[model samples]
Target: MDTSSIVILDFGSQYTQLIARRIREQNVFSVVLPCTAKIDEIQAQNPLAIILSGGPCSVYDADAPPADPEVLNLGLPVLGICYGLQFITHHLGGKVSPAPRREYGHAEVELIDRANPLFSEIPANIHVWMSHGDEALELPPGFHLTAKTANAVAGIANPERRIWAVQFHPEVHHTKQGSALLRNFLFSIVGAKPDWTPGHFIQSTVTAIRKKVGSGHAICALSGGVDSSVAAVLVNQAIGGQLTCVFVNNGVLRRDEFQKVQRNMRDNLGLNLVAVDASERFLAKLAGVTDPETKRKIIGNEFIAVFDDEAHRIAKQTGGVDWLVQGTLYPDVIESSSVKGPSQTIKSHHNVGGLPETMKLKLIEPLRDLFKDEVRRIGRDLHMPDDILQRQPFPGPGLAVRILGEVTPERVALLQEADDIVVAEIKAAGLYQQIWQSFAVLLPVKSVGVMGDQRTYAYTCAIRAVHSEDGMTADWVPLPYEVLKTISSRIVNEVRGINRVVYDITSKPPGTIEWE
Candidate 1:
């Protein structure tokens, strides 16, 4: 289906994925490419319009990133945001300078031209979220300022060339009519139609997978989480009996997760699932690895090794296995493959940075373009059970990352017990679905406490619960004090190792959902 889509040039903005999500919500398809993407790559998507994402860089920097000069001359409608706005201005004969005062929070924007299509139905005075250190001090040739704040230009437009730019982030929830603004740009200006949906995605993906892996067997790393589960099932739908799913038990899974997931895959989903107990092997390799990155690399390499061994065995039994399917989401791709964006590598995802160069099988990532919620929608459309669809987001590296220090049996057991209690309590409080990701991280530090009137030193556990639309950005869940009290009390009393419990109050900007 030749769908009308938008091409989002990623400048490593934290909100770049949010912009794509907003466009998809309008039932229009969108894809994100790196800022350094060649002009041909941008044109290959046949985008109806191009959107330049906001980033954490100033256009006037010594090594400032710039889009392809050819993109400006493509004659396609371009919308620049934040750093993107500055880039468009500075590159096209306009002046950009550092703001005297950086705007970092909510600010009111007044529409100077009420007739502008981008601000079609928007009110005169509206609030927007701003995060920038530089501003487009002067408009480019043929550009008119359409909106302004008290101290800076909020928006500029060149109606003749169909170029638009905004200083504030319209994709974030802090903006009242952000979606409306995007809709105006997508529909009113670019003439795009809302035609994308989960059902359409499922049908198209099935066909694509079938065409990609024809007559060849494929192996999927099934963690039984929503992302992997959906990927496994979708591929199974495409090539039945040709897909062998390897579920590796890395000694860091939640309590009874392996057994339950095994049963579900075998009976519920009817996948060709193989459960590999490589826990001891993984633990032995990670014996004294204290560094988080090292632990991740060990786990990642071990996972691939196990998968390779299993694949060889399967190939011996069958003919051969040529592909490895993963449930890698867009955030993982964006964070891992950030080429020109200022977005820093927060943490290495196992499925991403952990893969070995020597691995023989090619990767098939169906959900690479989708977010967490979008994957859930596709799972629902496939009639997956609520339990599978609502499973909490688990890292591919498993509990190895959850345990702050060394990945060992003792630490894994302690973290698993504490994590199990956290989940059980959250489910008991009827807040499981309301929260995005809730897990327990076993801190490396130990504290002294009196247990049964005897002084003892034991591990301390940190509980993290966050509210997020997608895992791209999150805020700590403002759990009720009573809920917090219950969780803390339960973890300390029920879990044997932990002496104390602490809750993470940091948001995604300063902290990630996972401690590692």
Candidate 2:
């Protein structure tokens, strides 16, 4: 279970986690450490290799972040990326100059030494993703410039000392042969072993949970999403029947999702369950809330109020509980960090900010350090039913975000009906397992349409479906025309007030998963 091959020091790079993903894809275990990680902590990990991630700030900035110098002195193999490369060059007495013409994307790299360790297996000429304003102007002593692009030095290597740096990102897929290049650096140069798996993580988390919540009861908020369900089952394994699950049917949930999730939990995991029907309360609070932020705030605060009241009452009925378990994952941490440079705060996670500050319960986050795929594996290990394990991630605010305008009971019902039809059709077509996320959105705008020779002004429902690995970056899934036709037909026929159903083909840069 102690499989540590590569240690990636995050320098506020947006693609820092992607480097770890690539390493894991090669079956080599890797861990991400903050750039500010202590020298002792780095040494404690005993990494076979190190990769310095790219950052956003200039090296001359007063508070510009840099990796601890001791990380380089560890006498282990190292690879530096983008800002990481510049930092390495500047740290080792090389020169970094601000480029008058900054390189942003798609630079061709010409390899100077085909025999170099980093380029050993990779081709001599390749394309790399470039996004830096500063370029290395000079190489340090004993270091040889091993690659060049049209603009400046693209790569540097000191074979005598196992050090290498690249101005372009080898982590992103835009860089051709990136995996092969990283594999050469990890396996051929650093000699790393591939040994990380979900079973190991499950055992580690179970041990941690047992130690943290010994003889104490815990309550988990079951949103019927993969993350929460997996976290619930894992925590359930640790504390057995002491864990009480609260499934809140906020009015914003997908059509009949409450009943479906209830069945899943009972027939699947068989844990202590309390189904709270608080839809009317949520709908009442959400009425007339047009702004997205206000809707989120209102829904989040209301959800906690209902759940907290239920938990307090449950405690009085049964016994006292100590921990409020959550399914907080790793991406939530990285996306929330103030240190991630130039990264846009996509949306505030409700479960993260929903809890009241004065709540006295301790937290048991079993999936705190995990990713989506890792959560799925833990679900599989816990023998959770496939229905729960394969369910797409649903926001804690549910369909509240999917509705573009005010959260009304009528709109919520319409959206739920449309969403259920889409989900059921996808499941029937055997395409549910292939898509990462699929949902219905109730756009605020109403359009003119004619049904049975009667002109009517009705809401336009947009269907969003995308295929992604981790929900970070995604492309719209090219659903078959037949499947789309079926979903559209069902939505228009079954869901009242929806005159039209349109598929959203826009990707993440222009549109988010949720309509709001």
Candidate 3:
């Protein structure tokens, strides 16, 4: 079945991606486009509905981005969010001005007209997350006030025109009935079908891979993480013997990761696998590269070089390979490309845009359109081991970025030991599954500490543990004091390089999950 979709017009809002994720949660595909996207670009998705995302800018600003006025005439259900509501009011001959009292957090909206389809089954009084300074003082000609809060008009709607606007963020988790409100708009207003599923994705993806590969030899860059492993398994299932998997040990892996992954691929996955120990080559190029982007680029280029060499060797052994498989995910693509509005390049993902331009093999990314959780579901459907499916996300550059300075064999060894302790302690505390990513970073600076009666100086290690639904946003995990103590003590006492241990308490907005 063709997946029904919704189009989310991003107005440079931080929560725009969350809006897309929420719609996808309802089993309807959602694509994000810039608010300035042309009318033709908006219609190309054949979306059942269009949603305007909230933004930081006001509608009255001289440089404020505007959607094509023709979008409202598209005859599709349209739901405008915070800034979206202000845009609708300002553009449709309604009055919009700065609210008498700005609403920045949670607020309650009383339904003034609950009969509207947008609030079909929602309660009369709903708590919502509000983050806006502008207020829609008057409704457009055909619109009526459907909801209101103490500070401003909460919502306005025109059932006949299938248009609705809300002055609060329904995409964030703070909004109590946000999901239900979105469901009403998606199913009741837009009449979209919920047909997207992991099972359906697996069947369709396998079929697609077979049709594209068509008995051609394919080489998969296996990182031993869930994404790449799942991609490798899916491709192997599609074209059994035509697939050859290459596992590169870049010398930046976690403690004992290379051997564990190599054994698992050989004994458990049972795929035709080859392990390349190019740690020295990678470490050599990464030497004295302190800049994070430069390190990422170096690692990326070296990876492609290793893969190219392997591809040539494999070709001589078994004809020629035509495809290079990667486990690139949706966030990687979105972050790497300006696909959804004017997005900042957060970081360059190793698998997404990191491939060298000179590569000759055709690319096959089976999991490119999927999120991490969705990829996990596909892995489970493929009967992958629970450990592999639930493993925490690791960067392709491995500990190179985590070291936060020049790469060296000694620093890599120190980090590996400290990182292993973190995992061991977290697993022992039974908090491994609850945490999204938990690891230890080896900071370059050394701190003084007392060992018995003697003073010692060693590298300081920082521990980071975060809780997140998706990797896009995260909160630092409030770990039990005892767990923290255990990890700190273990790292300082057992590991040779870490004298002091500190926890990262910052969240995603001001601080990224990684120190680098």
CA RMSD for every model?
3.2, 2.9, 2.9
Better of 2 and 3 by lDDT: 3
Candidate 3 segments exceeding 4 Å error: 288-294, 336-348, 404-406, 446-458, 469-474, 497-511
TM-score of candidate 3 versus the correct structure, residues matched by position? 0.90
- Per-residue lDDT of 57-126 in model 2, one digit per residue for the tens? 8776788885577777788988999988888788888888898779998989999888887887677899
Q: Candidate 3 local accuracy as lDDT?
A: 0.87
* TM-scores of all candidate predictions against the true structure: 0.88, 0.89, 0.90
| lDDT accuracy of residue 293 in candidate 2 | 80
For model 3, residues 200-267, the per-residue Cα lDDT tens digits are: 88888888899999968999889999988999999888888899999999989998889999888878
| lDDT of model number 2 | 0.83
For model 3, state the Cα shift of residue 457 in Å. Answer: 4.9
Local error of candidate 3 at 420, Å?
1.1
Q: Report lDDT (Cα) of residue 413, candidate 1.
A: 88
Which residue pairs clash within candidate 2?
Answer: none
